[model samples]
Target: MRGTALGAGVLFAGGLGGGWALYTKLSDNITADDAAAAELARYERERPTALVRGAQNILVIGSDTRAGDGNRRYGKDSGTERSDTTILLHLAADRRSATAVSLPRDLMVHVPGCLQSDGHRGEPSFTLFNSAFEVGGSACTVRTVEKLTDIRVDHYVVVDFSGFKDMIDAIDGVQVCLKKPIDDKAAKLRLPAGRVTLDGEQALGYVRARKSLGDGSDTGRMDRQQRFLGALVSKVQSSDVLLNPAKLYPLLDAATSALTTDPELASLRGLYQLVRGVRAIPTEHVQFLTVPREPYVYDSNRDQLVAGRADALFSLLRADRPVTVTKKNTSPGDSASPAFHGNTAAEDSCT
Candidate 1:
């Protein structure tokens, strides 16, 4: 999930060796500079104290907003933002492992009052987790997440549709495999079953398409997205993007353009330091999973976290322990999400 930022940071660290003159391609760009500055300027009140030194937590948000030309073409410019996807990325102090936990957007929670555009706080209410984004942007969402997980979010990165597409193209493409053919007009995606390489547009379609791809459930869609991110991690690790500036510049541009980070991580040096810690971690140590959840007891349309399991998972992260996810074998009729199902970047689509 955070592989984009991690990869960019690790690559930039090496680029820095060539001197500041070489990085003018990134620092001089107005869009990236302004966006970085905006993230630096966001104000926050409550933040959790780190339990482990050198360990870092970042919230990666996939904003479903039609604010840019590249994104407007895909959806209506509703003038409001929502988080389509959110992942909590944890980097261990030893830098030997990374854990990414996906929070369901439909999960119901209490949204606290947030600072509004008018400079006053809005009223608090109970709503879906994603609603926090619409109510007060990223900070509200962070607050909601903090309330839910009891963990401090050290930083956050928000990326929109176009930014995601651009990043995919910058890296050439991510490889994926399908068990069956897909043709979803609503998602603007079409592909035959088998091994395939998807470019920017196609990759976006693949990740966003749910109706014709899986069981037509958000959980299924999230699983697919996680797999795609796993593939992306592999691509970055194996490719020469880090060693080649020609390839690195476009990635930096695409990543920075779409990113909204916290003040501390808004600069190139700060980003580099955050990413450097995870560069040496083996791909197998990077895991992706969701907090255990089920249909809300009161509303079938919404989701409720499975308390015991969810708490256990959060506790592990809080204590800086590696989460253990056992791969479960599912029968053909099983559609239930596994208790702990996740794949490492070392495992490709075919795996």
Candidate 2:
């Protein structure tokens, strides 16, 4: 999701006057996931149909692969990776609002059979949601998400750790207010309490640091990630960045270089069209929330959907209906209410 916003920033910079050569270079940076598209084409009949004509649902995946150049510091390259973070972004038909729903990697869900890298079809199984990525990469992850939520996915984007860090550096830094100090050696982060600005490396650790933070649960990490993203979006939309071409150029480069998307969004023009629709959406209209879930019945570490609540949230998104969310937590069994626990981009994290 952060990559999507940063990529859109490129269009604004390009329009200012980089000429054809620079535009070509930036556009070429985006990798087209033709393999995933081909795999998805095989299951077109099984995929859900798009309900709203102008609405869009994009799956933004943060890949935790340690094989890359700058990523070796995180861990050893095990020749495999999973979806470290996954968010389903829904843009309203009117383009007045957007909702980002985070899906926990530990959530237990039914994964549909998918074609594996070994050139064989793997049998369907019930397992951790992130397992889909480990088995078949983006194609399998998309199929699993589609199966989990009946909403159609129009496109998908994969971003990596190095790219994420580069984007933060490009934007200077994102400001965050911490109530307590943090010193997570595992995440390579050490920061004092209160308001502070985080560089690319620190921002990565801030969002990824689980054990040294509140509750030490993925849920807490997800909430912190949402808040940090909101802060990033707010910073990008500020006049200081948008009004300056020098600032926009680095952001443009970092964003395009970071993404791997489906064929439709693999080019500058396609991404431009997407940005044009969403660039004007007000900050207050941007909502962020996690899917309703509870600890898995069989295992305390795993998660399961909160029965009727999860289905209700999915239903609203499928129809492109408005989803209202509050900051306060709601009962897991409360399905009659329309509002869920969440926060908007307009809210100040420091407050």
lDDT of each: 0.76, 0.86
Please list the residue runs of candidate 2 whose C-alpha ends up more than 4 Å from where it truly belongs after superposition: 1-18, 329-334
- Top candidate on lDDT is 2
Tens digit of per-residue lDDT, candidate 1, span 316-341: 78878877765446321212332366
Give the clash count for model 2: 0
lDDT of 2 at 341: 87
**Distance (Å) between predicted and true CA of 40, model 2?**
0.6
